[model samples]
Target: MDLFADDTRLTPMPIDDGELWFQQRLPLDLAPDEVMRRLLAETGWREEEIQVWGKLHKQPRLSAWHGEASYRYSGKTFHPQPFTALQLHIKQTVERVTGRRFNSVLLNYYRDERDSMGFHADDERELGPEPAIASVSFGAPRTFILKHRHLPKKVQLALGDGCLLLMAGALQKHWLHGINKERTPRGPRINLTFRLIL
Candidate 1:
């Protein structure tokens, strides 16, 4: 499939040695709030622990893995759960907008101000060279931080409700991206990152 041929609405985000495209809103069958509510109730969510630097620590957020492939990260392997009807609908919508194919999805839920993820690259070997990752967010907005690996550069993106962010080309190899905990109270938010596992 020619993934980039028909994507006309995505705005390019500038960065060194990487590619990014952002759409303020994604096309969906249901309202973003309704979808968020369904996701909060129907999907299975897990609080996981990861080993870092010989120490085990619990992840600050709840997550679920879905689609055809299992995923491994942070010294743990996540077996896949078959996608729900709603999730499949979301996956299809994402595919249509991005014109990219994906066989797996990582769904993350941040309950409030205390949940966060540190800066990290998604350049796992199974993602192949130059994987295209599409991120779709629902609910409240949060800052997405990106930093260059070898340059004194940083970018902060406010990923709001129902938006789409596509990270492609050499983005994973050249930059680190993450979300930080907010000092003030924030509303619940959910993000889905779709990937094609090789």
Candidate 2:
């Protein structure tokens, strides 16, 4: 983990395919613990607290995005949850490192060993084609899996606390990714995925 660095540029994906570029690393100013605490306190999100689905309409999981009423599911709409100072700091750092401005972000809080996101692409219409997604992970380390859409190759990365991952280009078109909830003891994790919504 590149902890305590202000920001670091990452290796860009090879470009035989069209549409995608990215960078990943921990934000320079905040420590891992500080990021976690502020996220929990500001969101008023208790560990394992499940909110109504905000984006993915077809899934049995907890999710939140944009705080838009139209984006809500399960009878509860969130009014654009304000970003904490830590969130803004990280976002700025990401923008600097990736050289891309992100208008909106989607926050996914995975509590303990049960909360998990199923396989899917970040290919929403608002994301536009060849979307650039910069993901910053805090708290417990989790396995992020990527599988080819037509090919059989699968890749996995252990996202340690304060690790940053970037997915860009046609990676979304040719691949799908997700966090699986099997049977392993884990701590709370806050994932901030910065995106550009058209």
Q: Give the range of the ten consecutive residues with the poorest summed lDDT in model 1.
A: 1-10
Residue-wise lDDT of candidate 1 within 113-162, one digit each (tens)? 89999889999999999999999999988999988999888888888888
- How close is every model to the real structure, measured as TM-score? 0.95, 0.77
- Itemize residue pairs with steric clashes in candidate 1: none
Please list the C-alpha lDDT of all candidates, in the order they appear: 0.89, 0.67
Model 1 misplacement above 4 A: 1-8
| Residue range with the least summed lDDT across 10 consecutive positions in model 2 | 67-76
lDDT of 2: 0.67
Best model per lDDT = 1
